[model samples]
Target: VAAPARRGRALTAAVVVAALVLFAVGGGAGFALTRALAGASLLPPPSAGAPSLPAITDEAPARVTTASAATANGEQGAEFTIEVGADWTSFLEQRANRGLAPSTVVHLVAPTGGYEVSVQRFADYYPRHSVEDYLSLVRSRWPKGQYFGEATDVTDPLDPAAPEPPVQFSYRTVEKATELGRAADAGGRDLRRSRYSRVLPRGADLWVVEVVFPTEQEEMGRSRLFDTIAGTFAVVG
Candidate 1:
C-alpha cells in the first residue's frame, strides 16, 4: 500500500483534520502558530458546516521541519510511535522524557512561535477523571476550563471564552469509535477514516503512525502497537 499523507506521522488526513479544526476554532494566534509548525498540510479550511476555525498557515511563509523517531514516549512504555519531517525537531527534543502512557499519542507544533503539544491516550477513554481530561485541563492559553471528571479540551491553543468552540466534544459524545486491527504500511501512505483530518500551512504534508493489529488478536494487536511506539523512539534535531 502507499504511504499515508501525513505531514506529521502516518496519521490520515481525516484524523489530522478533525484534530486540527477542533483546536483551531478555540485557539487564535496559538492555533495559527501551531499549524505552521506542523508543516503546510495542517492549513486546511475547517469543516464547512461546523463552527469555523481560521486557516492562517495557508498564507504564512515559513520553513517547516520533518523527522524520523523511534518512540514518542522515551523508553518507558508506549503502544505507538510517530515521526514527521524536520519541522518537528524542537518539539521532540524538548519533551522526550515526560511521563507518557502505553497508548499515548504525542503531537508537537512548531517551537519558534509558542508551540502547543497535543496528546491522546489509547487505554484511557472519556470522563474528566481519565488521563485525556487531566492533560487538557491544564492551563495553557487561558485559565483551564472549569469542568472536571469529563473529557474536555481535545483541542489546543484553546480560548477559555469564545463563541466558536475549538475542541471537539469528546469522542464519547460526537461519534462512535471503531477499534482498528493491526496493519502495516512501510511507506505510510494516505488514508481516510471517520476519525479526523487536518489542513497544513502550505507545501507541507501530514501523516499518523497508528498501532494496528488483526481483528482476531484484539488485545495482542493493541499491545504490539504500544511496544512498537515505546521501543522505536528517537529525538531528531
Candidate 2:
C-alpha cells in the first residue's frame, strides 16, 4: 500500500511540472507576439508627398519670408519672389511633411478686403506638361457659369526672353459668400473675379499665380492692383 501511494504521488508531481512548462512556453510566445505588434504600431506612416510631383532632394524645408522696404513690399521664397502692396501679409500654406520637397504654396492677403493671391510651384519631371496644358486642365474643372476671358501672352517676369511666353487670363465665378468669409443672407452667393497667370521659369519647374477679389471691388480699382501684384511674380533662383 505504501508503494502504490508513492507511485501516485510521483505521477501527480510530473503532471504539475508538465502543466507549468506548457504555461511558461505559451505565455512567453504571447508576450513576444504582443511586443512585435507594438513595435510595428510605433512605426511612422508613409510619406505624404504628392505622387505626381516627386521631391527633388531631402534638403531642409523651404520657407517664405516677408520683405518690406520703403520702395517695395514682397515675399521671398526659396526659388521665387512676389511683390505685394504694403498692407499685404504673407504666409506659407500648411502642408504635410514631404521629405523630398518643401511647401510649394504661398498666400498673400490684403489688409482690409477679401482679396487674396496664391502662388504655387510644380516640378517638370512628373507631368512634363506645358503651362498651356495645365491651364486647359484647370479650366475644365471650373464650376458651371464660369466666364473665361481670352488668354493673352504675357512676358515672363523672371525670364522675359524665354521661348515659351507666360499667359494670363481673367475669369468670373459665383461662390457661396460663406466660402469667401463674407457675410451674406442665407443661401446668398457672390461674384468673384480672378486673374491667373502661368509662368515657366528657366528651370525645371513652373509657377502659377492667382489673384482673387470680390467682383464688386473691380470698379474700386482692385483689378489693376491685382494685375500689378500678379505681374510682380518672378523667379529668384
Candidate 3:
C-alpha cells in the first residue's frame, strides 16, 4: 500500500536520537534510518528546524525516576534517572483532550535499557484501517526488517479469534533490536513541512518512541505533537 509509516515531524534534530530508538523498535518504523542521511525533511525551507527525540537523561524540572534500564537500550548499558511532572496526574489530565484519560507508559528493557514513547489520546483507528493492512505495508516497505512478516490479518473483533483491543492495538517488548534514529538537516528548516534525518555513530543503536491517536494523528502522525514527547529523552531515568 504505502511506505512504512515513519514519523516525519520529529523533522527536528530528533533524527539521530529517534533513529537510535527505532533500532529497538525492530519493525518498519525502524527503517526511518535507512531513508535519510542528513535525515528527511518533508516540509518547505527557510524557517524549518530538524529532528529531536525526547531526552534520555534527567533534569531539574522533573525529579529523576531512576530509569531501570539505565542508559540506552543495551546489555550493560549506561543508566540515567528521569523525573516526570511532579503532579503527573494533574499535569497529564490537563493536557489530554476532554473525556480522554491521560496515559503515560514507560516501556523499560531489563538489565540493559529501553526507551519510553508515551501517548495521550489513544484510539482504535484499526477499526477502519486494521493492523493487518498496516503490517502488510510495513513488511512490503521494509522487507529486511526483523518483525515485518505476512501474518494473517488479525480477525475482526467480532470473530472469536481476535485478541482484546481488537485487531487495532498492540505493544512491543524491550528487545536487543536497537536500530537507528536522526535527522538530515538542510540549513534553514521549515517547521510546517520538514522531515528530519541523520547518520549514527559506529556501534551505536537506535530507538523510537511513537505517539498516536491525536486529532491529527493520521495527518500529523508522530509529528503532530512531538514537542511534548520529543524533549523527554533526557528527562526520565
Please name the candidate that would achieve the greatest lDDT relative to the true structure. 2
lDDT of 1 by residue, 93-207 (tens): 2232124323333455543422222333332221213323323433221223322222333333122332222332221111112212213333222222111211011111111
Model 3 worst lDDT window (10 residues): 193-202
- Each prediction's TM-score versus the true structure: 0.21, 0.52, 0.23
lDDT of each: 0.32, 0.57, 0.31
- Lowest summed lDDT across 10 adjacent residues in model 1 is found at 197-206
The root-mean-square deviation over C-alpha atoms between each candidate and the true structure, in angstroms, is 29.1, 19.3, 27.9
Q: What's the true lDDT of residue 101 in model 2?
A: 28
Per-residue error for 233 in candidate 1, Å, reads 17
- Candidate 3 overall lDDT versus native: 0.31
lDDT (tens digit, per residue) of candidate 2 on 164-231 = 55666556666656667756654345655655554554444556677776655554433465556665
The C-alpha stretches of model 3 lying farther than 4 A from their native spots are 1-64, 70-75, 81-83, 87-105, 108-202, 216-225, 235-237
Per-residue error (Å), model 3, residue 213: 4.1
Candidate closer to the true structure by lDDT (higher is better), 1 or 3: 1
lDDT of 1: 0.32
> Per-residue lDDT of 134-229 in model 3, one digit per residue for the tens?
334333433242332122322222223322322223222211212332233433332221111111111122122333221212234323223333
